[model samples]
Target: MTYLVNDSADFVDESIEGFVAANADLVRRVHGGVVRATRTPPGQVAVVIGGGSGHYPAFAGLVGQGLAHGAAMGNIFASPSAQQIYSVARAAASDAGVLLSFGNYAGDVLNFGIAEERLKADGIPCRCFAVTDDVCSGPADKAGERRGIAGDLTVFRAAALAAAEGKSLDAVHDFASHANDRTRSFGVAFSGCTLPGASEPLFTVPESRMGVGMGIHGEQGIEEVDMPRADDLADMLVDRLLGERPNDNQRAASPRVGVMLNGLGSVKYEELFVLYRRVSQRLEQAGLTVVQPEVGELVTSFEMAGVSLTLFWLDDALEAAWTAPATTPAYRRGGVPLEGEPRDADDFAAIHEQAAPPSSEASRSDAAGVLAVIEAIQARIEAEADDLGKLDAISGDGDHGIGMTTGTRAALAAARRAVEKGCGAGTVLTRAGDAWANEAGGTSGALWGLGLRCVGTAIGDSDSVAAAAVVQGIRDATDAIMRLGGADIGDKTMLDAMQPFANALAEQVEAGTCLREAWRHAAKHSEQAAAATAALKPRKGRAKNHSEKSVGHADPGAVSFAMIVASTATTLESIHEDVT
Candidate 1:
């Protein structure tokens, strides 16, 4: 449990501040994350790695002379926003190119992919390679569907080495992709990691049981089994990893591989030592030549009592890269010549500011109503937070409720502030969206942010809001969500409820129905759609790995969407009556 924090809300930000202070010589602070303190050689490929904040050395500690050029840190257990990633990338970008690497999680994919797009559009050469290495997350045929875990370090190290070799962007990307393909990992957890401020753990394992195939984010495991001895545990890790060796590596009679026995968090070096001993003996017996073996915490999950084993089946290039000289705050090998004094924390290479869009008094009048609707949703989400979190924990990390509540509360506050400032409807929503995205920090947060921003775009400030405009706004929000999140209506996400709501709203508005009546009708579709998602399987995100476990539960995102829209319909009806 994370018991030593001052405030749960302040933990991540405060920790980041302390990290930069402690590693002043190795890294400097950018708005989103940290970059190397020393200047990158001109035309060097800046390898940027990142994800959520809790994992220590795997991300920020890897940013130095030889590993990642920078890292885009997000909230604890949440992926960074696109803005955050873009900011870090801009800080780290050089004339050569930018290579963005992160684990293959839904929020990380959306945020990092968005950053890549923006970087390219800005005329900076950039590419992203998401690491997929956890063998338990998917079958060999669907390897890309696996979540990246401890094996992320191997992929990042190999990519950074290729970049250090001054390889072209294409070459670096290919190197990282190959490293990801050849790598495999499996983990077991004795206990769930408790997030900051939470009294109880996310989930619990029986006192004598262990969770097998667990994720880094406190996600549900594939199965539970009686706890075994250290040697037995080592065997479990090695056998599972060895069973899924890359198809290309089958040709080698004795394949050379990189091995990592990683402690997830609270597990000490003494315990890890016990596990790694047998791991080494068994691999050699299985005709595998273990190259440089790492037996310590490489990636962690916020004090989780767990460990994961990673194997990177190495080719010639991978072996050379794996043994390359590197220097970082947490992990280091060989020597790097000192250039000069490290850069100041306040020093920045590039910074960009976005201005608010224009709004008129007419739309500003409508914003008051928007604020009321948002407040209604916020209250509803607050009421159902525990239930939503429980549902999400069945397959996901159980943060959906917390993330949604944080986002809605932030949105509500922002909307209220905008109303006080006499902002237009579009401006109110735009500010609210930005606040939610910034505060919540997750896949759902990003999608909701996009949805609100697109809605604001369609409902411009100059014009008085009309039925057609409202319908257009709803359609635009739906389209933006689909474009950004890559989820179809049947994917058991917010889109499951959103699409039905949009269709019903548009159809009713077109039929000359009153706005309140139309919204009520549309809300019913959303509620029904949300309920129907219980029978469907999750096709994307972290939940996909434990899809079977969530069979009889409604999607948290879908449920939240339905509940919010239903409440909003009631608010609209109240507003209509008041206006009448």
Candidate 2:
């Protein structure tokens, strides 16, 4: 469906490239994403908002005066890597601090949270606020767990306005959180969206039917009903959002509200205006005074034939912030007085990589085995990529397979480069992990990347990797995943398979088994653990919203982890033969 793409994997990058070129006066390219062309006043809180790349205007388009200072763009429907977020934040942070805001998605939260910690360690004040505005993602009591949709515009604007007003980092963060609390959104889709180079849509709706409560990603709606006319659909969205209005707006005689009727990609502005006509009439009848309501595509999902409506209940402070002047390439308001000069060429800095550590001869020999294992993993992922995508499509955005392939390919290339540099197994793995995380850009990518880094840390470059070291590395990697991802054994994530594999490998190694035999034994347990996920409901990630849909299917992440371990076991067998 994406007719203009050269390669599916390069779509996001190419799009960002062209976007920066077109809006050179408004924005400039950065290592991870984009920043304002002009400099910000020193010591002012910088607002950096981002998520995946499919949503246009949302992240990159919102970067300008009185808006986001920068954005960290990710792969298609994937969250940006922690390194990407960190890079963007570092570029955007002023003397005061940096405030990171994004939609409430698993990968975004994990990656951004990690970036926040990294920034803090660098002595930069940083805080993260995840926008949870979709009313359909969860019940009112669990609103904090809801996914963010088009309502991101309201929250991002509020936070950016506070930052533009020279508020402290704490004040900017509070304003963002308050804006999130007061916002609610609901959406419906007539059809699903297709990723670049994909033959089919992510999900489909029957003719004359509409999917209710659709997500911005390729996630299917929670429910479906017969399609209705424009006015009827408007009523549905308005009534749903009004039912979940913030508590403070419930008793107001005439509450003023900010409205956003966002078209998800393909929906035309004419159609949106028709829908907003009824939406406005209904709000007026409900005794709510509408403020400057936005009626267009603020956030999109490629070419999804859907639309979402957001209601931002405005307090006096919120209204002032909402009405503030803003100048961006996509979204513009009243003209803003420019005080800052044009950005100089030297303002952009390159992201530098550390040199690989030295390795002993024995450790370098071990590095060859690591490279072989990574090659085997990549081959296995390439073979099973389609099936993995199908499994993920049951409950998720269905990009896991593509992400794995991208990450593994990057990992293999990085491992080869490290080996050529005479690095040890640990350094090779560490570089590979960094490459994977930097390229993949998703929840699975972040977890696997950090997990590999942890394993590499446990196995130092200076020494030969022994069975005991391997066991310790697995244990450390498992623990790191649990800590970073916040998922346990039964969460239906990669941890389900990885944790079992780690435990089994440790038991076998402690029982005096050789590394190759122990790994083979652990692989079986991982296979069984991955399959066992079919009986459990997902308690985390985007899949949680559609848990019932995935009841009979194994988790894609768990299955992929098991497959990787099994493939690595075969590589270990080959290594054993060579050593013997």
Candidate 3:
């Protein structure tokens, strides 16, 4: 993989140097890998934070006027050396002394523990708190051992505020520790990520499957499960969080929750917001008052396809600290402060607009044959999902199988319901398209949805989809796919299969061949076209990275497209024979 660095060993230093250079006015690099903001308030208790690199904004990014007094930096995914941690502790001390805050990881604990002992020996007065917020990382009985994820932000913010408020060093430590206790996080990854200049990813999940409880460093998760819709994923995460509902049975008190929808890295903002909408809805349903929900890359791995959820049980002290105005390079609350606003009113409507509307047409069975064919296609994909994912993994993000399976399953379910309702092929396809859009939720989803919608438009009310109509449908679907995905035939995508199928169907129609014969011809052409994609280097889409490795492997998207066309062809041939 291409990397933006001079050397893997120097990656951390280069990045921190650049960071300090950019924010030199607000931050100054100290002796022990610590970046201290020059404008720390006088005589205040100092707040020090540290963590591994790559998860930016956690340790260094939080250093500013109202946040950390100083931050210690570690190498990517590796804990800072003990000497580095001690240096940061020495630099961040005030008359009230310093409080060291960092995530709960083995390396971090060992290094930071050494730093704490060294500092105490020198009579500098230092204490330490660890953020153990990731619920997925450890069992309930051992939650204290769980690695901290995005919850580091909440812990740091609380500690910073306590220090800024003239609290004693011990008090600041207590507040930060309290914040850590209240926070919990869980994460899922669709794909693994590579370290800078590394040729291989740290770990990988099969296509159409998610790694539940995945850590930030590409660690194998607790389980692998079939990927679900955005709403379902959000629900699962929220349920796990709410299931451990903090005991608030004391004295008539309402529970307040603070949510952070954090992107691991390289996940588009649009996809993140889709998840945020669902997360907010689930939290509301759980009867928790969500205050000032945060969404974005608060903490991130290096371009990993994953997201983590952090929920903090809010209290007066923590809530006050959370709402306190703070500025950092990655996190800032510059807008109207979230405090004093009616807590019940969540402004998520703008974000929730991405969920497409359902089909207006009622379901029906006039398209039973078409529905059967779609189901067959769906079954084929489900059966071959693992194989396809393996193929795609050679050159792509290994999601083609999952994307195809997800889109087809949704399409089949909708089509089956339409058939039961006696709907025509057009209505079935249109409804299936709508369902695909609502369930799949990605660039591939939009493409498949458009393709189905266009095909539906071409086959409107036809008792049998004729060869000419099938040709037109393929043309329409191809056009829509192109418009949505901007991929062409040689891009090693489904377009390779689709374009050939459409052209062959048109030729058969011109020659006045039987629908069965035309379909057979189209399916044959589609299979060949799909195989041909193996020879064509990918110029776009996720497969661009392994274009050479992909040369001998059929494009998963193309292979699936051919399979669908073949299934449809076979089903239509049976129906034609019955009619004759």
Which candidate number has the best TM-score?
2
Ranking by lDDT: 2, 1, 3
In model 3, which range of ten residues has the least summed lDDT?
339-348
Return the TM-score for each candidate structure. Answer: 0.88, 0.92, 0.57
Q: Write the per-residue lDDT of candidate 2 for residues 295-393, one digit (tens) a residue.
A: 999999888899999999998888987888999889999998664667777777565445667777777888898899999999999999999998998
**Model 3 lDDT at residue 578:** 19
- Model 3 misplaced regions, further than 4 Å: 249-253, 334-580
| Candidate 1: regions farther than 4 A off | 95-97, 120-123, 249-254, 338-369, 390-397, 416-424, 460-470, 511-517, 541-553, 570-580
Q: 349, model 2: CA deviation in Å?
A: 3.2
lDDT of each: 0.84, 0.87, 0.73
What RMSD does model 3 have?
24.2
Residue pairs whose backbone atoms clash in candidate 3: 364-418, 364-421, 364-422, 364-423, 365-419, 365-421, 365-422, 365-423
TM-score for candidate 2, residues paired by index: 0.92
Which candidate, 1 or 2, has the higher lDDT? 2
What CA RMSD would candidate 1 show?
Answer: 3.6
Write one digit per residue (lDDT tens) for candidate 3, span 1-580.
Answer: 3279799767877888888888765566764454455434456777888877788866788877667877877656655645566666666666677788888764566456556765787887788888888887778778776788888899998988888778888888888888887888899999888888789886777999999998887654688999989999999999998876556442125578788999988777899899989999888776778888888888888888899898988888888877878766566765322211221212111221223233322212336666777777788888888988788778655656766777788888888777766666677787787566434434455556667777777767645555566568878878756654567878888889988888888888778787777888889999999989878988765356457888878888788788877877767743432122
Candidate 2 pairs with clashing backbones: none
lDDT of 1 by residue, 454-530 (tens): 77767767766677777888898888678767888778888999999999999998888888999899999999999
Find the 10 residues in a row with the least total lDDT in model 2.
571-580
